[model samples]
Target: MSDPIPSADPLDDLRALIRGAPGPDRGAVAAARARDAELTKPAGSLGRLEEIVEWLAAWQGRTPPAIHHPLVAVFAANHGVAERGVSAYPASVTKQMVANFAAGGAAINQICIAEDISLKVFELALDVPTPDITVADAFDRTGFVATVAFGMEAISGGIDLLCLGEMGIANTTVAAAVHYALYGGSAEDWVGRGTGVDDEGLARKRAAVEAAVARLDGERDGLEVLRHVGGREIAAMAGAILAARHQRIPVIVDGYVTTAAAAALHAIDPHAIDHCLFSHLSVEPGHRRVLERLGVKPLLDLGLRLGEGTGAALAAGIVKSAVRIHAGMATFSSAGVSERGVH
Candidate 1:
């Protein structure tokens, strides 16, 4: 039979996915909690570690959560805004870094190796940078929808956990602009010294963010705001977050830029990122603000701002430890340890 014709509305499928997103598995959560109580440890002594295990169980839909095939996916793109000198690094660094990733020379490569996780770098047309948001919308509807589709396709290949990150010169500026559009604040509230820009560069970056948000004229839709200000990598990361929700894959989001990308989804549906874990608090100033806005606490605070999934990969090790502790520790009965308050 011939394949069914695609829907006329480009965003119809995405809308349905968001509306039909799944909730946590109560049975699995209960099972995890029960097992935790039986473990030879004081209740709540494990702290966030215990909470992490429960989150995994709820999202993975299993009694005890596991991370057998954790994958870190990094999307790299170039931005037209880089031409405005918002970042200290040249756009060529994005391409060079992609090559470095391929050569196993980047920090992410080493982290994945250390954590025994798989790393995949996706280059989103490094040659074709998205339009400078300060001057115009970054993407038309069709292009934005297509980039989101690419992100959805990224979730395939039987991965159990997903870590989302991005690489692009001036992407921090792009992310700041998106945040400015979504959450009403001054450009300084959203912009940061990406790649360690100088005072002049920081001022230019702030101006770019202000102009980008002003050009939008207070648009309300979350996805529309993203389309106006987001680049290919940010759009793809947002798409991957949504796709992971549908596929039941828990996500670990990297620092500032990734959080900004996720903010778009959060705006679309407050609970859209329920399955996600913020990996770290970036040194980037706006990261803290965005995290506060989302009301989600991150797993680490190491003053890390380097993108390329480095922070997420590091946090993945902690997650793996939580799973191991949950699954490997002996129960009170098995360990013959007397329960508290026993006669």
Candidate 2:
């Protein structure tokens, strides 16, 4: 064979890392499944919980998959789209919410405290709101790379599980625009009442998304789409997810904003998703469709529209419980219980 040609894209290294990331360990999965079959319970009695064990074992390359040092990172930023009167909350709310997060006044903070999960909020693109995507690129190429880099850095260290969340005014608008760009469709299908936008404000959000979609470059799925319609925090979360996979740290994904980032990365490279778990479904209209496109089901559907990683923190406990059940439950032989066929 001839020598392979070298790639020149700035994102090539990251892309290579993502694409090269390993999936769940098949040997571990086989062992876990065989063990499950021999357990006291009937075949597939635990449903997705059983499957979660398989997934965790496969990724950790051990039986009863492990969830260690759960970390939640909420990327906070401001979207220029918020300035267009699309969101019920003002752009200043993004900053105010960031303060609230730091002060432990936000929902995510209380959830993290109760769960004993480490939570950090990266104030990305706070002072510098992303440019209005309808009229110009939200961020230049370097800026996009830098934003992702900031997230990757924040998530560094040996984290067993990482939960991603976002806090940005009008980010849903940006996410809707990105969704439309990646998976072509009516903006109406992706648009929703972000932060309780009224009918008039929702209409304005749709109009903005439609215009942004109309102007997308010939390049439909790369940095162009991001700079055109992605929020800084969205980009940051995407980067963090990708890096978590690269580092063998699985991610627990939160609501719409975090899901939107995951979707964008999924569009880029689906393999990255092997390192992630869908935490919950949000009330946001676009969330279900995003999960559908991802071909995964969330662990919870709690009518959550609040972001800031609250969903991820709640789901973290469930993940640990799954592993605990897998590791702790007595086997058929150990418990002296009759096997399914015998009983």
The top-ranked prediction according to TM-score is 1
Per-residue error at 178 for model 1, in Å?
0.9
lDDT by residue for model 2 over 32-150, one digit each (tens)?
Answer: 89888877777887898888788777766777567768889988889887888999988998889889888889998899889888988888758889888878888877788888788
| C-alpha-based local distance difference test score of model 2 | 0.83
Candidate topping lDDT:
1
Clash tally, candidates in order: 0, 1
**Collision pairs in model 1:** none
How does candidate 1 fare on TM-score?
A: 0.96
State the TM-score for model 2.
0.93
Deviation in angstroms for 155 in model 1? 1.9
Residue-level lDDT tens digits of model 1 in 1-343: 9965667876666766776799999999999999999998889988999999999998999988989999999999999999998999999999999999999999999999999999999999999999888898899989999999899898799999999878999999998888888888799998889899999999999988988899889995678888999899998998999889888999999998898778988887899999999999999888999999999999999999899999999999999999999999999999998878332
